[model samples]
Target chain A: MSSREIDRIDGSALPLRGDNIDTDRIIPARFLKAITFEGLGDHVFEDDRAAMADHPFSNPAYRQARIILTNANFVSGSSREHAPQALNRWGIHACVGESFSEIFRGNSLAIGLPCVTMSAADMGPLMDLVERAPDTSLTLSLSDRTVTVDGQRISIAVDAAVRDAFLAGTWDATGLLLDDFEVVRGVASRVPYIRGF
Target chain B: MGKTLLKKVWDLHTVRPLSTGQTQLFIGLHLIHEVTTPQAFDMLRARGIGVAFPERTFGTTDHIIPTLDQTRPFQDTLAEAMLSALERNCAEYNIPLWNLDSENQGIVHVIGPELGLTQPGMTIACGDSHTSTHGALGAVAFGIGTSQVRDVLASQSLAFEPLKVRRIAVNGTLGNGVFAKDVILEIIHRLGVQGGVGHAYEYGGTAVDAMSIEERLTMCNMSIAGGARVGYVNPDQTTFDYLRGRRFAPQGDAFDRAVSWWRSIASDADADYDDVVEIAAAEIEPRVTWGINPGQSVGVSERIPATGDAGTNGAVAEALDFMGLVGGAPIMGTRIDVAFVGSCTNSRLSDLREAARIAKGRRVASHVKALVVPGSRAVLAAAEREGLDQVFREAGFEWRGAGCSRCLAMNPDRLEGNQLCASSSNRNFKGRQGSPTGRTLLMSPAMVAAAALAGEVVDVRDAL
Candidate 1:
């Protein structure tokens, strides 16, 4: 019904603890002037590159990886869509965190970046595995909601609705609204003074 | 059963239920900006529909207008055309406009409250997401699309489904250094951005009650991003006082009557909620955005999360690959090249005052370039009267005129290639500050001030 396109990404397990990861840092605000999200992967941290020349992203260990896992309170300021656009553009499958900010998470999800939340306790083993093998590439099994790196399973919790959405591949809430519109309208009309509203 | 503010406002505004799964809801106020209005106005012309109620509609230019060099025939041709179209449309429709020359000119959200157009117990609509900013005045403001914009223009009524309501109350006293911005950042962090989808947030509690109207406005403004169709703080003494001397607020006996009516509409003490969240003020801090989004943040005292420490969303391997950041770095000492203080988010006099307090008697780092822009001509005048401009200029901040400078970089004010800036404006998404490689660090104005002085991500308290 709207011009905005939506996507549904399958669930994945990711673990990382970083604070102050902002929209500029996520995709860098400078990339917004561009007509498209294409090629944004290079500028994800245009601000950080000048600070740390040999950053891991500059290294070759991680490539073609999608999805970001972080601790509580991910994406905190500004309602810039480029952050999620960049991640989604650059093959980032999804973002999982203990908690997420309102605007960042919404904008991300609107454009198909699934922001999944898991408990801290459930994320410990996965985080521990990453710490021990810093360069290890891990895979998250969405069917069973398990994270595995080098054959070892990692514990992580995910909400059922989010998991189902990921598996079913639909991120549009409006569809949900429309599906229940008849019932919602019926109930709304019954309420005095609300039939018109 | 808990009824949301959307339900209450919708019920009050409904003239009739439509067969198209939409209720015919009445709109008390309609706000418009430049970018989205042109097509709607054209559509109105095509349908031969003049605005049904011109008095209820207000217009301003923000999205496409240049903040700097606001002279005629703007540098961007598209922007210039949009501006002219808005002016032409406003004139033809007899709609009141707050053009660049008008004292009320600024972001649509900024001007609504100043003009007293946004008020308690009203349903407002604007062709912008941040229309939620008006909800602070206790109005249920909805962000509509161009078609909806046209609908309001042609009919003065819109069809809409109902929504549930959530009551979010923050009790206790907010400590100094922490602000409404931080409080909101904390809320978004805890609840996630989509937590309020299909819900209206009714903010209350001792802490919210104690906030100045401006502070409360900040909290409600970002509710749209959090997926709230509407966010409102119940009208009280604070709301009434803020509107008392304004142009649109009622006067004398009428004021008294209005206040009584306003008070009656607040959620009663026993009002139920579909959901309620309580956050302590003491837990909040002078918030800043470190990642490319608003929610990826922590206290100034905290360090960057280690890759592994980032929960399932951390995707350390991937973020580190893209962001060029390693795990476990200290976010505090991160160097910055530029510092900006302005935007609809935090460009008011109070915001300037806080930044000035940190900048006074301290020189910015030699390599750092700092800019201070007010939200409006009035805010500019107030800051000048208070000598805040001198304080900033003396501290090496470029004291510029009022506009949405450096917020979205539509003007000359922007970051160079890959320049790291500590910015008070909202949104840090890459290139949001203009340069294809520019980086923005979102923070409170005070934090920007502190960072300007240190040329790094230093805490404002440290500067204090």
Candidate 2:
């Protein structure tokens, strides 16, 4: 098996409930000027944490949580990979949400941070459970396609190809695409536009 | 059943199918910028890899480049370091770069089309999310993150699962003062911010066809905000007309041949789509975002939705609370402290012309600090040639340099604490305009011009 294979994750959950929690709120554009993503964890949700005293990221109860639970369309807007990098550096191994924006999901998957989804109806109870028991151990099993918390098994959805990438340990796509470099050149040669049609 | 442009382009670029059920697709063009490319290049260096097709890649400094004064070293050291890193990376990779001194330099999305690097029947990728803006030319463009950026840099390809196509047809003609910006805003309002997820939006119909190439770019630029990774308008005479004589466009007989290929790639008349959404152009009014997200908007004449009216999710309530606005309050007459017209969305020449038309002979309110930024140096030169700059200056609006000035506020140009702004840029996300408490009411350029004159949200039709 490849060393990068990520079949499961076990952790406490941090609940940040909201719709359309965009990347701007997660990291903000001001913090994006750095050449590298180092030290980004300290600034994740910097604005939100400063604005609201009760912001979940600033709460002490979820300080050690390795997973984030949020509402629909989580991590939308701006294809900044810094958002996922910040979360990854901030000790988040996974994110469970009602839905995730396409680019955000791709970015998360690229970094090996599984962003799984559950229906809104199913997510409400899970979020409530996490809020009630912040330290409750949550086990997300990609092999079983479920999240087990407090003896309750909740079915989750992962895009088939994304799940396959994780299970096969090919989530870092650069190597995979580079392996097919000749085929890529062949495809480019066949396209009329690429050839100055 | 017929094929869509997206399908045709996807098939044309597919290298092979992988075991993960993902297609390894070739990217025709790769656009890079400062903020997102530094780490991507670092990743390549760490892996001992080189840019596989450096000629296909283009770099420009935009995100961190200051608008007011773009000297060798920016006032902000981080911004300067980022730009310097981009220069070094592009040079090392043998990729052509349009730095601050380059006349062709501007927002990557704007310069791509302006330089004719963006074309129909191609697949484009960029590190910035607004890379979808190139799709206005009938290309299938995607905004990718840094790792994917590295993937493209090293392999000139990326793995992707196919997306379903949703044809959003807007019929009839747009009324006076309604623009492409308003139409897109209306589409986002009707289709919630997340509604277009997993779909590539094919924008067509009489209304969309009526739009100019720049307007189409404006419409496509915000596809990401609407949760769509890609959006496109099929290539037509309008597209051809705009491409003709552009710097990078094919010339002479090659141009004619290219057009035929572009025409062939458009969705067939009987094209099958996974879903279709219909919109009436006349029904779409001048829209303005009243809350945190772009979808949380209403027409200028409408009132903010109350808690009960918005829905049970409490998103609207939170927006209202954060925005410090009362539910059921009319969006019109909302006071504004700043006005800006710039961004990849509506910073082209046509956008400036529209804003200039509204600003002519009208003085900006004493309390309102208004600025108009061109999308590119070319757009600025064109505006200056037509005396548009004079019109804006005489009207008391600051005519600034070409860059993403107040849009994301990565540079010096930004809103102050809690300043409410009438903006023509895309995305009204909280803290998007730099200040944590800053508020952005996204509208058309003309609407922003009118708001600057009135010092509050106002109907551009009335101002006209």
Candidate 3:
């Protein structure tokens, strides 16, 4: 997957609301054995998907849902890139939660999976709406910092600099770092221990 | 107000501020292991990038290394390939690797401090989450993902957002048999898993100051479990004494100069902090995780939390169903099928010695399968030198070589289906110990030894 500027996502919401939904629960360690993240979506919440037939991901209506609404600290725990990869591959374009883990949010942003957070009070009504109308298409507009559903808007906030990356289409740190190769080399050359390779 | 040690280190290493609200900080030491670096090196190769500062990077085989019969052409093909990929990548890039054959080889975290490569006031990064283990020596260290690892390898720097420093002070004295592992577990229990979000934990206070380096390392190693990116202790005379004679530490006059600088970087008496939390060390008991996550813990003497007491009723019921545990019951005496004592968390020399002391005259239960895997090759040798290995072996535990054995189950050491293991590792996530249905209960090394002897989770205090 490559980084793309994500300004807006419009889709029916699939709500897996809870606190501290850690990466291990998102994609367990056993699924990370693959050489690459290929086919990880098949195992996303594998145990949960197996045990709870009623898990939202297994619901026929939410199968094509592109936005996941969840509670605080979503994607917390181990620094496994597979967590975001699984969400991305499973057709989640964005995650709207009360909070997200630092590393998990970083990984998601790198993969173009926008993880956005709102206040607990704001999240309660939003989750209520999503749960009430699972098929209602919600529009998350990064440019305006709001999520709109059926002409009604719920204003949201993302880190200003992170929003700038999305709006400017420069979220790829690797690409930018790669462009400044000479400067990196200059800094590396001056380090006391790094005289030569 | 004076700056905290974390701020001082960040100020020292800042290269530039990015438009993305992150600072590019020069990494003093870049450590890598077999599991996370292969794909990172592949990213570099794809980008036609060589390691810009190869000398700052060190490689080791840990995650996938076998603890028994580690011969050429490993029995597990994927494990051999991963190790080979690391060897080939390091060789091609001129990065020094402490291969399995090298005496310097061990768990990446253990080897760094023991070899004296990890020092005070440096920024250390590794692809593994437990890299915070190095912070016990007064450095600012954290784990990074594979992409960040690639960035560090190619640019010798990382773009990182600043973290608020939360000073967590544990005062008073700990009870007997309550180790550093219990202290951290108690902290996580009180703070909850997500309480440390967007903050770096600076451990302090009388209890923290009195801990040995090994005990401190154990505390910092699990800071991630509390959702903190970094955990550290201030450098002091104890830190200097620990590094004085190590192979990579500065020698003679250079050592004195280094010590002078290190002393300057310790948190000032009136340093500023974003938040302060105080805990009474006396309140902590030997902690045992009763649920899937590290934060889901109870004291050995306490009852499992009622399902209603858990924040979400669904999560509580789900965890109980998954772990085959009943709510409101005592945490001790939970039967276990396996016992493992090894990980970057609790696999140092002192940890092994403590476990061996508990196992000396006892025998493992007939129904239990127990193993002792040291953190590094050096730790393995040190344990054998003191006959700790013999003590464990005579008590029916298999003494294996050094590696991250049974930690994440990336190696041959793993649990079978539905088997519950009392492990000294950091994580207790479902399926973390190999089998999809396997269960893991996180505890201290001596607790694991006692569990092995009893064929169930038992109080180490009783054995003591």
Per-prediction interface RMSD in Å: 8.5, 0.8, 3.2
List model 3 lDDT by residue over A1-197, tens digit each.
22677799999889897777877777866566545667988888887677688999888888889999889888777777778889889999999898888888877776677888878887888778777878889999999999898898888879887887777776767765555666666655553323321
Give the candidate number with the greatest lDDT: 2
Residue B131's lDDT in candidate 3: 84
> lDDT by residue for model 1 over B1-464, one digit each (tens)?
53444556667777665443346676778998765567678866765657767877998876655555778888766567768888998999999998888878877777788878788878888866677788787888877655567767776666555667788889899877777777877776677555776678888889999988878877887776465757889888889889887887776777777778677667767676777888887777777666655555678887666666736354445434444454577778889999998877788888899999998998999999999988777788889999998999899999876776687776678788778888876565556788756777778888899899998888777666
Candidate 3: deviation at residue B204, Å?
1.1
DockQ measured for candidate 1? 0.09
Poorest lDDT segment (10 consecutive residues) of candidate 2 chain A: A1-10
Which candidate number maximizes DockQ? 2
Report the Cα RMSD per candidate.
Answer: 8.2, 1.1, 2.4
Q: Per lDDT, what order, best first? A: 2, 3, 1
For residues A21-62, could you state the per-residue lDDT of candidate 1 as single tens digits?
555466543344432345776676565555566654453433
**Whose lDDT is higher: candidate 2's or candidate 3's?**
2
How much lDDT does each candidate structure score? 0.69, 0.92, 0.86
Give the TM-score, chain B only, in order for the candidates: 0.94, 0.99, 0.99
